[model samples]
Every structure is written in structure tokens, then in C-alpha cells.
Target: MTATAFTSPSLSGTEALLLDLEAERCDAMKRADFARLREILHPSLTHVHAKGQIDDYESYFRSGGTHVDYRQIDRSELKVQVLGNTALMTGRQLLVAVRKDGSGTVRIDSRVMQVWTEHEGRWRQLAFQTTPLAMSVT
Candidate 1:
């Protein structure tokens, strides 16, 4: 998958950099590039799924290769706020993947919030949470 281009002129340098890293993270997940993911995610990372499951850095990385196969991860409407050494990012994410436990595929359309911080001279994702958008009544 091609990387999402960040062409908005209104974004600050930090915001642009953070969004670029976010895109890279999504690409890494789709490609199962755990090595690169390790560099971007913090040791204390907390990832909360839309289905209410939570995973830390280790479990999150481990699940990528063994428990779930990611097909696509798309993000849009991204906004980032920088506060001192920390950043808060919010966006919409569309994820499609399959479970290795014979449960077939899963797709999530949700609003995501992520926390990142400057650690050891590099920005690393510290936490992530998703809230599923309510389904429209037919």
C-alpha cells in the first residue's frame, strides 16, 4: 500500500512529522514489519480495541503475526496537538483483518485517539484507543 501523503500547509512541523509516523506505523502493521514497529511503539504502549480488548506493546506486536493478519489500515481526518514533549492525535481509522482463531474477518470503522511522547530523542506511540461509530438505523 502506498503511504498517505501529508500535503496540508497548515500543519506545524511537529504535526506533520507525527502524521507521517502514524502513516508509517499503519503501513508497518499491514506489512507485518514488527522490527520497524518496535522502533515506533513505546514499551508501555496500551492499545485498546474497538471491541473492548486491550493489549500492551508485547501482546500487540505478538498478535500481529500469530493471532491476526492485517489486510488494510486506513486513517483519515487526522488532527494532532502538540503539548510540550507529548502529542495527542485523533482520527478516523478503517481496519480490515482476519482472526487466526477461525473466526473469519473483522472490520472496524472507528474514531481513534493516540498519545505519543518524545522518548529518547524520538517520538514513540504510548497509547491508543478506538471508539466504534454508531451504526445508522436503516
Candidate 2:
């Protein structure tokens, strides 16, 4: 129920800051708040979906509601590394999405890698990619 990397005694304050920013980014996505999403995303943000589709910042914003609506996102197994002005984040995400009819939800579990840049004491998402994970057979 915890991320060891973030809990490590050797992890610096910068690491914690980046981790917090990551949480904020996830919240923004679930809410689908365009303004917050725009502010958090870099102008040149690059996003790669699990199906290998690529999206730039403007494309992503413009494609809202046609498909790919996220109702909730739960992140786990997070590892973050801060390198000067950028942070790299890897984690497992459980994303719940609404059906087109709005009657039900579907879950997509994926492994995600996100890149964040620090600018003038603020963090912005620069790039992100997610890979779908096959469920384990018990």
C-alpha cells in the first residue's frame, strides 16, 4: 500500500515535490478540468496511449468527449527520479473509464512512464506513455 522509493530516507525534498505534482496531475485528469490540465501540461507535451496512438497537447485537448474519458485513476508502485530540472515517473495505473452510453465503466490497468519538467518553481508534464498490462492468471 506504499511506494518504497518515495518513502526512502535518502530521497530528497525534490523527489517528494515531484511525487506530489504527479498526484495533482492524476487528479486533474480524472476531473477532466481543461483549464487545470492545460496549465499542468507543457505546450509541447507528448502523450502515448496503450494502443500506441500518439497525441500532442493541442490534439489531446481538442479530442475531449469524443472518446477516452477517464472517470477515475488510481496509481500505485510509483517510482520517481529527479534529475536537475526534470523528473521521471514510472507507476502502475488503474484507470476506470465510462462507457459511451454512460451506463457502466471499464477498467484499464497499465504501466505508465511520465516526464515532468520544473520551470520557475512549477512543474509541468512534458511527456507520458502507458503500456497495457496483461492480467495475471491465478
Candidate 3:
């Protein structure tokens, strides 16, 4: 783990939980486990796609067209901010996905921000937004 200059104990715990959630989400995506995804997401959650499309929890689960198999994901520079019962998580993620046909692969590197709220003593994702990171010109 890289050293961070500033840290908060509460934020640390939130960050840990968010990281765990991200891992579980990745697993669910790989297995197309809608049930698990449903559990993690709040009832009124909204997911904003990179393509300017917005999906509510119900719509996202019903899409059924997200069949890409994720090969791996790399996450870094995560920060969590806690406000009362809500938390905001921000980070960078690199994801590699392959089509089921085995024809090719797609890689995406993006910056993500997610809002999670504690409901009934458990945290659930309320909203998530992601933006593709611009490649650096070396």
C-alpha cells in the first residue's frame, strides 16, 4: 500500500468496506450474479454509464445484455469521505473485459465516484458515476 499523508479512522473503515464492495461487484459481474448485485445496491440506486445512459436498479438488473467477461481489474488511489450515515468513495480503476466469442478484448481505465448510505445498519450503494480517464501524451 502506498503511503497517504492524511487519513481519518472513520474514512479508513469506509474505504475498506468500499473496496470489499467493489471486489464483490466485480465477482458478481463476472458470474452475472444479479442477486448479489441486487443486495449490494440500494432500492433507489442509480447507475450512470460512461455512455451518458442512466439506469435505475431495476433497469440495470433487467438489461441482460452485459455479457462481457471481465478478466481483471486494478484499483488505486481510493479515498473515502464519511458524512453522518453517508459515504462518498472515489478512485481509479482499470478493467479488462473480453467478449464471449473470444474474438477480442476491451480495456477501460476510469475514475469512479460512488455514494453509499447506511440503511438499516448496512451500507448500500445509492449512486455511482464513472468517467473515462484521458490517456497521457508521453
Most accurate candidate by TM-score:
1
lDDT per prediction?
A: 0.83, 0.76, 0.74
Tens-digit lDDT track of model 3 for 36-73: 98888999988986566898988887652265676766
**Which rank order by lDDT, best down to worst?**
1, 2, 3
Off by over 4 Å in 3: 1-11, 100-104, 134-138
lDDT of 2: 0.76
Question: Mind giving the per-residue lDDT tens digits that candidate 2 earns over 18-134?
Answer: 776677777777767778888888888899976788889998886632355677778888888788898898989887777555666667689999999976568888999989884
Local error of candidate 1 at 45, Å?
A: 0.7
- Candidate 1 lDDT over 32-110, as tens digits, reads 7889999999999999977688999899866654577788787888889999999999988888877767678878788
Residue 113, model 3: Cα distance from true site in angstroms: 0.7
On the 0 to 100 scale, the lDDT of residue 14 in model 2 is 73
TM-score of each: 0.88, 0.81, 0.77
Model 1, residue 6: C-alpha shift (Å): 3.5
Scored by lDDT, model 3 comes in at 0.74
